[model samples]
Target chain A: MAAWGQRLAGVRGVLLDISGVLFDGAEGSGVPIAGSVEAVARLKRSRLKVRFCTNESQKSLGDLVELLQQLGFDISEGEVTAPAPATCLILKERGLRPYLLISDGIRSEFDQIDTSNPNCVVIADAGESFSYQNMNKAFQVLMELENPVLISLGKGRYYKETSGLMLDVGAYVKALEYACGIEAEVVGKPSPEYFKSALQEMGLEAHQAIMIGDDIVGDVGGAQRCGMRALQVRTGKFRKISPEFTASPPLFC
Target chain B: MAAWGQRLAGVRGVLLDISGVLFDGAEGSGVPIAGSVEAVARLKRSRLKVRFCTNESQKSLGDLVELLQQLGFDISEGEVTAPAPATCLILKERGLRPYLLISDGIRSEFDQIDTSNPNCVVIADAGESFSYQNMNKAFQVLMELENPVLISLGKGRYYKETSGLMLDVGAYVKALEYACGIEAEVVGKPSPEYFKSALQEMGLEAHQAIMIGDDIVGDVGGAQRCGMRALQVRTGKFRKISPEFTASPPLFC
Candidate 1:
């Protein structure tokens, strides 16, 4: 183990980002990254607690589990964490019926939930369904509702897909925000509460666990803000890390 | 004519806004305003040069002429001007093939133009077609094309529709601009060049022309900036004209 790797030897729990670090979208069929399967196998052999942390709002939790398992990862449904559960909790607690502006692939996650007479707008990357009619409806709802809330799954600007870097939910979310004159409560990575909750689920302290991911802002920056050590991989959406953002610099794994 | 209307009698040319002034969308189907049709007829009988200037990117120039004529206005296609023609002209002059991001209603305007291997993005009110896939493609093209130009039909935030004030192209254009990190060149009303061109085409100087509209910003504000007299009608999207914006105030007609 390298010096940074040796420092992480005592880590009891590992939080890993699925996309870019473990699986590359460019590989088609969500192929696992080279050596990531072995790395995960070794972690499993060591009997360390592992959780796959992801901000993919396009798919449901069950779908994510199936994809990860098919890609040769020893991950279960319980071991995967995403923003949907947290978002759902918030909606229920606040008594808000969300008009989900998410992709069709993930709409099943909220199928059982009440969305009629929606007073809240839950936005994610809706792909081809980000139509003008839907957006206008959301805007009209915001205008008509008193103190309407907007919940964002993630604020990622772009994602690396099979083709190339494509815009995520951030741009479209910002458009709704600008037009409605409201800000969205982000529910995914980079939120300290979200990271802390994941750590708590693993029965580990922030300092005793390490996070591995490709995205600097959503993973490294977020994990570090929660006082967890982070490792940044150069596989997906990793351009060049700036020195100014090096306070909790990820150990390049 | 009212006392305010008398002042515009000496005006050699009239630059009129279509939406909210001559035609009201609140009546659903682009219905003409009360008495406005006869008013335009009187102007036509007087042989006063008149041009219908609009920022409605939802329809084509030919369609606008047909609608205005159906509403009892004696107007020709040549007397109608919109952002689409100006945008098309710019695309042709710059030798750029446009990936048009406009409404299906107006897409027919560009059917005769070449759009293969698009090097420019022409954005308008692309109602319902503003999908994530299309925006990502535009962003990618902007990143890949050498000096890719982004042309906006208008930077309007909302338009008074039959339903209510609905989201316009401004929000989407701003979103694309934010994601791609580029500013779009607006080609519609409020652009001083657009107003000046209308006056030139009418064979009249800006000072000798009078502009009339309901929109405070896109109509009155734009014409006054071009050194033309303006009239603010209380029909469409016009609220109370603030004193702060009264330096080049339009005559309330």
Candidate 2:
């Protein structure tokens, strides 16, 4: 067995990051990464449970799955643990109506949640929707509430897009945090709750799964913190080795 | 003499903060604070050289002076050290054309400087102009530069407006800083260069000047850090005693 295969011996499930791993972040429709289709097929052929965990807030799970399918990846909406759906679930569970500061593409995911009289602020990768009016409106909503609840989709600082690296929700989240003097609760990758929920959906323990991703903090650090074995892939956003993973360099694939 | 008067005995120049000290941050033309008009007249009558040092980037220096004149302040454009004019001067001195991400009101301040092919990004309190498109545009400009230079007007987290506290340029500056992994050079209050410029206009050293304002960090801490005596006014944005000034609390007015 290979060294990586030896490390995955006890892994019962596979948690994969979609964007940057299976496909690069292009303008509209993403181009599937080379061999990612074969890799997904190989994973499905195995007895291990496969789950696609992504912090992609720019598109709906269905749309994302459709895009992946068109790009020749064996991905389904049911197998994905995306931020919007996870956030919607969290909002429904807490009975909190949110004034969403997210991309228009992901708005339908929150259709079930009441947003008329918002009790909290839900922010995501809003892209061009992150206008001052929208941000101030969200700020006003958060300020009006006695106990402001700012729920961020993910806390990635920046992401590699086709144009170049673009500002992510974390930067805006930090802005709101500084302005409001409050911390935001992140709902996507690196949040232990998000990782745990993905694990629970797979009917597997944290130690029973192996997370494969390209993002150093969001994917590898997050999964590792949640007690899951994680592999760092060199494709997509993986520019260089971070100091955090230097000690355990064998995890890189 | 009172303790504050005693502290001001050696002060050769007075750097007054316009918005918070002279008047509250009302919508249009600010209503003068009670006794502020009289206080300005009194300062004018005194031997001490007085200069208005403001981080107000929402309007041009001329407009701000006009508004203050309307609200009954003894002021002139030459006697004011506003961030916009100071930033324009810096841009000219450095021979760097800027792609401005500032409020439309303050655009005239940079009219003298070349903005055709920007070598740097200049940001300020853009108000409703702090949209995703503008921010992204600024980000793209900075990313394209070989050595990115972000010049921020001020580093205030938030400011008190008539409605409530509003996000300032600092928060957006931070967002850009995080996105590009670069630090911004602040051209307004708390920046030693800005303070020194104000003092240079009065022909006085840092120790020979006094700063009086409501903003604890921007006015008091900034001036104090630059070796000037500073007094905190219990007006705009002064909610509680910051620990940084607790040791010398007698400076409050």
Q: Which candidate number has the best lDDT?
A: 2
Worst 10 residues of 1 chain A by lDDT: A242-251
Model 1 spans with C-alpha error above 4 angstroms: A1-14, A25-29, A43-50, A202-211, A220-232, A239-253, B1-14, B24-29, B42-50, B111-113, B163-165, B202-217, B220-253
Each prediction's TM-score versus the true structure? 0.81, 0.87
lDDT of 2 by residue, B1-253 (tens): 6975776778888889987678876666666767889888888899989999999998988988999898878899989988887787888889999999988888988778899888999999999899887898898788778789999998888777666667788889988887777899998998998899899999999999999887778888899999998887766655553323343342224
Q: Quote the positional error of residue A93 for candidate 1 in Å.
A: 1.9
Candidate 1 CAPRI level: medium
Compute the lDDT of residue A203 as modeled in candidate 2: 98
Q: List the residue pairs that clash in candidate 2.
A: none
Every candidate's lDDT: 0.79, 0.84
Instruction: Give all candidate RMSDs, comma-separated.
Output: 4.8, 3.7
The weakest ten consecutive residues by lDDT in model 2 chain B span: B243-252
lDDT of 1 by residue, B57-168 (tens): 8878887788778888888888877898888788888887988887778998887678999888998987667776677788777766657689999877666665677787
